[model samples]
Target: MATVIISALLFVFVLFACRSAWKRQRNGCCGNDIQRLKKVKIKGDKCRDYPYRSLLHIDGMTCQNCARKIENGLCSIEGVCATVRLDQKEALVRMKRPLPESLLCGAVAKAGYTVLKVDFLPQSGHRSL
Candidate 1:
């Protein structure tokens, strides 16, 4: 009877601990808060043209921090700038020229994530004649 009581207490304690941890994660302690997204600034010359754009789908992102890490990693590549959307699990990358998908995948991998796939979004008003 005493053993059963002890086990029940332990189970309750563990359940509460897990609930607390989950609440913290949902509250954005593990990553950037969604409320702070508007405050984020990427300093670059917007007037400078980027002719190529690609969308990267990534996995293993638990928070905005993961998205930021992947963005920073991709931006480190020459002539590339990236904006990562945590809600969408996607990164919109703009480049001065086209680059191989492996390069982008490697960047995500280096940031401790996996690239599930990449898709090129059609550019504005450029249909095949």
Candidate 2:
């Protein structure tokens, strides 16, 4: 009987936590879902036809600071929105408009790294927005 009560309490706590998260999401600050979700790196918006996101390989990302530097550099760029996973050694970028592949190649180069590959993201029918 005690086990059942504890389990029920735990379940209710989880439910409340989820509701709090939902309410926070509802606030909707920064940008809309479209701009946030419907973004790709190389393809941008114009190439709605062939939007692509890249897993950029940064050759010299030796540590978290290195990865953070790359993330900061890329994110500072006007059109670039980047999420970097240091453990993965990848920078997932979404562009405001279809940017030239060379731009990524160049910026990363200026930041002191190497570009491995850029893969186009297929509309999983459930990307971005």
Candidate 3:
């Protein structure tokens, strides 16, 4: 009886832990930061400050490789750092400026894709962390 009770308690603990991990993953899973180099090719004194992390919604990416290409492509753009996550088919960008809608959408289009939409998220003073 004691053995069965201990086993059941362990199982319950594992179930709880799994649920917590699942919730965290839903928030943002398997994301890596893209760090830009310290210099830019543009003429002297014509540069933007370091980028800020921002999240955006991108549509039209279909697979893992497609997502990777999107990340690389977006990162290649001047003044932007991007991490593309395929699970949710979304691109999270850290950008020096609020990207022009045409700029981002057009790149994806040139890559033989289309951007269905983009949503901007503003920073808030509160973080539960």
Alpha-carbon RMSD, candidate 1: 5.1
TM-score per model over all chains: 0.64, 0.52, 0.51
Q: What tens digits encode model 1's per-residue C-alpha lDDT throughout 1-129?
A: 999999999999999999888877776644456655442344575512566788898988878767777888888888887888889899888776789999999999998999998998655332221
Write one digit per residue (lDDT tens) for candidate 3, span 24-102: 5553332222232222233222222333445546666655546765766676677776666777777766566677867
TM-score, candidate 1, is 0.64
Which of 2 and 3 is ahead in TM-score? 2
Candidate 2, 101-122: lDDT as tens digits? 7887787777677878766454
Evaluated against the true structure, the overall lDDT of model 2 is: 0.62
TM-score of 2: 0.52
Q: What is the lDDT of residue 129 in candidate 2?
A: 25
Q: Which stretches of candidate 1 lie over 4 Å from their true place?
A: 1-44, 123-129
Q: 1 or 2, which is superior by lDDT?
A: 1
Residue 76 of model 1 has an lDDT of 82
- Report the candidate with higher lDDT, 2 versus 3: 2
